[model samples]
Target: MDTSEIIGQSIALENVFRILAKVAPTDTTVLVTGESGTGKELLVRALHKNSPRASKPFVPINCGAIPKELLESELFGHEKGAFTHAIRSRAGRFELADGGTVFLDEIGEMDFSLQVKILRFLQEKEFERIGGSRPHKVDVRVIAATNRDLEKEVDKGNFREDLYYRLNVIPIVLPPLRTRGDDVFLLADYFLKKFCDKCMIKNLKISSKARELMRTYSWPGNVRELENFMERMAILCENQEIMPEDLPDKILSAGGVEQDKMPVMPARFEWPRLRDMDDRKMNLKDFLDKIEEQLLLEALHSAGGIKNQAAEILGIKRTTLIEKLKKKQLG
Candidate 1:
């Protein structure tokens, strides 16, 4: 039941872990609610792994994935000749998960009629197969997850109120990635290392500017999107370090990063020498000063005028940034 797989040190994520630690061993019906791609399935798996029935089958089925017409048979398997497709008897998720856990994913999308059946199982721990007369009992724990708002669905008559209560005995609400603060960077680095290892490439590191951009951008797709982006970088990155130019346009635009300001992506390594500086038609002091001023301005703009963050971006102490600002009459 190692939960190290669930990355994040944010207070929001830590609270989830605390609740999970308390409830994992219990048989209480739990409902995990979160936005899509927020790792609801992963949380459910952690719950099942830490539960008393860890050794037994941990069955999972996407209630929304199966067609509405066949969802019943998928949950509580059909008897032979139950329908045109039911030529042979088969066990359903509940039966297969006996003595373990049944993860009903996207349970909010379940048909109203099917929900009644699920509610019956939660209440009596018994269910009847499609076209079967006998009621079969199962010793299984139910854990349901959904990205939809079940409360609203219940009010709108889309989901049954009683079933919602039954499934929501213990609610675990997962926070979206945008609100997780520095956890974003932690996950970014983690995913970068992970994809690098998978691709058999030396691990790539995110540049300071790139890290700032990532921290600011709203990750609508959450960890799943970040993971995919990291894998893409691992496979496509031309350099060992990921810079602002290497990021996708979506990310740059989302972070309010100016694409023209980013360093150009070069196919090979190049260095700016004294001879290269000759084109600028300036002395070393003035040239260096201009470069320093531009960097300061970019850092301040990136940090949104937050002195501490701007200093960090510039790799200087806050006092140093302040002194420079005053010296340059730009404070």
Candidate 2:
């Protein structure tokens, strides 16, 4: 549902857009490859919407999620008396999506035995229900997506080689967030606006320091992770800006793709000394903040704010420290 929702002006996204432009009007089976949360489904939806089947239903099924026993019935439909629970006849995904598209997510996790059934339908454009003896044909286009390495799966004999080759006819790879240039910040801002509007909340923008922290992180979870973090930060945000201190340590500590891109973690800051603060009444937030602030000041003072040197001395995040300064109004 989100087109052009992708961020990043990097060559990676440029290439992705080029591919999308070429594939939008075709009925070819497209295999989207990337790490989890890399927006594979989003791309697939974009492709379907831009194609001729825009008005048709988009049936999405996670091959790995459905129980193997029920998977066949779910994809190919079943007669009223097909199985134990088949009290009523039902149309499966393939049958219902006759003129539209079927997105098979996590295709790599599909059971090997069931893989054969899918391959057969792909080649013949027809399938039979679990209990029905009649073979039915459909005109649905298939779009398979996964974060798994299918080549390796084929090597390990976990996936059928022919099936793998078939689905990969038009492969589209999505780059990780770390390599998407400034796209991280862009996506964060975009999602922030979208979520706030959906929830009828005030628009909030992430601070410049927060943007820097986001840019520096590697984002192992990719776009999905970024969107998730932004939504949470917006809810917890004090005003109209997302501060670095609001993010979790794990996200802040992540490394970006390029050494020059910046760190994913927040900067360290020096806070009131433990003895100077009320310890007995300190909550988890204050305690962690105290530690972060203290480490940063010590590191900065020890290394005279030479980020590299200070990092080696205190093993704290320079990006994170910079973030703390912004949050504590120390910057």
Best by lDDT: 1
TM-score of each: 0.77, 0.76
Model 2 scores worst on lDDT over the 10 consecutive residues at: 254-263
Candidate 2 error regions (>4 Å): 199-201, 254-331
Pairs with steric clashes in candidate 1? none
Mind giving the per-residue lDDT tens digits that candidate 1 earns over 186-271?
99999989888887899789888788778767777888889899889999998878886687755643443343545675889776
Q: After superposition, how far is residue 32 of candidate 2 from its true place, in Å?
A: 0.8
Q: Tell me the RMSD of model 1 versus the true structure.
A: 12.2
